[model samples]
Target: MGISVTNISKSYKNAKALQDISFEVKPNELFGIIGPDGAGKTTLFRILTTLLFPDQGTATVAGFDVVKDYKKIRNSVGYMPGKFSLYHDLTVEENLNFFATIFGTTIEENYNLIKDIYIQIEPFKDRRAGKLSGGMKQKLALSCALIHKPKVLFLDEPTTGVDPVSRKEFWEMLKRLQQKGITILVSTPYMDEAALCDRVALIQDGKILQIDTPEAIVKHYPTSLYNVRSTNMYQLITSLKTYEHHHSVYPFGEFVHYTDTRSDFNPEDLKVYLESKTLSDIQIERTEATIEDSFMELST
Candidate 1:
């Protein structure tokens, strides 16, 4: 088994963090938990990693119970928290050695497992982890997480603060790791990254909105989506929202993604209405649904 969560619930005093959430990751699969900040991604990760206990329900990681077999689960999973948690005063190499030693192993014993990720940071081995750049710190953290060659990896928002180039590189590294038969559970707030996973769970407000392959989720979008744009973007949004038949309108990059409540909706009808509002240079056309589109629909 890879990972299993059944009716897991957690709360923090007056607030509910995760409410009866359930999901599973198949062995060797690249699973993604996609959500916005405060969607309880970190809380769920902590529970699965055995750092925190769920208020209700149960979870297992790598064939070990999170509560009963916590020790076994800890040994079988590599966890990289969202924030950099390594010793700031320690040099990169020293930090790696410390983690390896904690797991009753040596860096040389698992050198091949982290070779691809470590080499990039090898030149900075002598530098303090806190002094390394954001990207370098990310590599160092991942190297330490994999120091013992755990069967499963849990990366919580691993690319949140990194530059775009580094984010891309990190995902590529994950792809290679998946090919090595290590089941990966990654959480991210970036909707664009959802497509890269084999499957994704879209969560919001402490609830699961949907779960499926990104492509399948897009294919099942409930309404016909259109991309609408004009010279006055602000006025266009205001006017679109005020329209009588409009179902939903959200700003997406350069265009507004719109859905109509009527089944017989026509672009020309919308174009005419927009022109009535003195919105000039209006462009309306059918557009393919994206993961972001599906998320917006589900979350609403």
Candidate 2:
């Protein structure tokens, strides 16, 4: 195993940030902590990186205890926090060099590790970290994190607020890094990214709702689900909410995802009923469960 989390828990004043969290990451595995805001993903990353002490339990990275072997853990792991934490006033080159020096190494010593990522941002090497575009800043931060060639990497919501193209590029970079045998623990609010990881742990309100391969998570959704949409989306949603046979109905972009209490569900019957209610352009279709759908089921 590359990382082991054993009953780890943390809190801030009266609010619980994590509750007896436990999981293991095998070597070179891309492990994701999937959840929304205030889900304690940051707290868990901070504790594992030895930045904050956990209220209870223990965790280890690269075979070093986060508490007693703080220095060793720091030397063997790279962390990119959720927020851009580099020296904003410093040029891109300066920031990367500084991080390398702090780890008792030079960029040249481990340049190969970040070469692929650095090339993209090298054109803006002299630009201030804050002045670079979001995508460029993201690349620089990732380069700095990998400069020391740590055994494990922790990324806390690394793609938040970035454009879709940049987000896609950033994940591709991670895939390359994974190919080089680095274990990654990344957290994200975007459910689509969950499918990219080798395995994921779904978290909400400071609890581990489920942990498994994304495919398995989706398959575990107990009830059959359908996607429905109508010209009067608002009325359609309201009608579904009060439908006696429905188990759950939630809006999902252009369509609403719905499940029911009946085992013998008939879409034709549903269409006739909606037509009688004066809803027009109603569309309904059976759909495969998604990671997001499974999350909703577990979190609810």
Candidate 3:
């Protein structure tokens, strides 16, 4: 129905790109891969889309083996790479038509497939892709990818570098596409984007850290977290380190997020100790866990 990857790995010039990465994407589901740059998200996406083969694993898209059925996989999946890969010299309409032709189809033949997204940039159909805005170019690229009416779409950081409004619009477009039974696998570096996916895989250094619904992942954070702030931030940080019970303390915005040095330490004792040191405007409050928080917790 969707995609299944097993023990995939790849390396480039002695540097590992993917290390035994594995995951499953269900049909009609919007699965996201979240990680920062150089985390192997792009490498994995390329392998799954059949643009590259894994060094030590097997994958299947729509039940077709990725390596042996490369052609079939290509025909069944639409991929939008992180970089804008459309023909710069070609007009929007030309680029769209070119991709359609390559897949042995015409724009009109798959008009229904991409009409919603394409129409937004259709008025500029005659404009060269190189001259269009970042968001518009992204829309055009997606339309071209979908022109063949593929069942699964792979977007590698498709919203990066776009304006906030455009980023929101792009995700909305993805939701609409999913309604038509198109399964989506998207990779993004933005932590906030993880919440938009039905499920997400958090990856780092070519290894997956966790895979679950965004809510579930955040809910799994085990330690009690507190937001502590003081006037002398540097001093407060240096002093907090001297405490024997300090578990983890890191700057989080205007405050330092801290967990107890000992599980039994009392918040009242911590407050009293801070006051005794004349740390002005001191405040400590429990904070909700976010994806970024979870990532920091896991990575540390």
Scored by TM-score, the top model is 1
RMSD of 1: 0.8
Tens-digit lDDT string for candidate 1 (237-299): 999999999989999999999999999999999999999998899999999999999998998
Ranking by lDDT: 1, 2, 3
TM-score of 3: 0.93
Residues 139-214, model 2: lDDT tens digits? 9999999999999999999999999999999999999999999999999999999999999999998999999999
**Which wins on lDDT, candidate 1 or candidate 3?**
1
The reply for model 2, stretches above 4 Å from the true place, is none
> TM-scores of the models, in the given order?
0.98, 0.97, 0.93
lDDT of 3 at 157: 97
RMSD of 3: 1.9
Record all residue pairs in model 2 with backbone atoms less than 3 Å apart, i.e. clashing: none
**Candidate 1 accuracy as TM-score:** 0.98
Ranking by TM-score: 1, 2, 3
Model 2 score (lDDT)? 0.93
**Cα lDDT tens digits for candidate 3, 1-300:** 698989999999899999998899999999999999999999998888888878999999988998999999889889999999999999999999899999999999989989899999999999999999999999999999899999899999999999999999999999999999999999999999999999999999999999999999999998888899999999889777776678778887898988885666677788888887777788888888888788878877
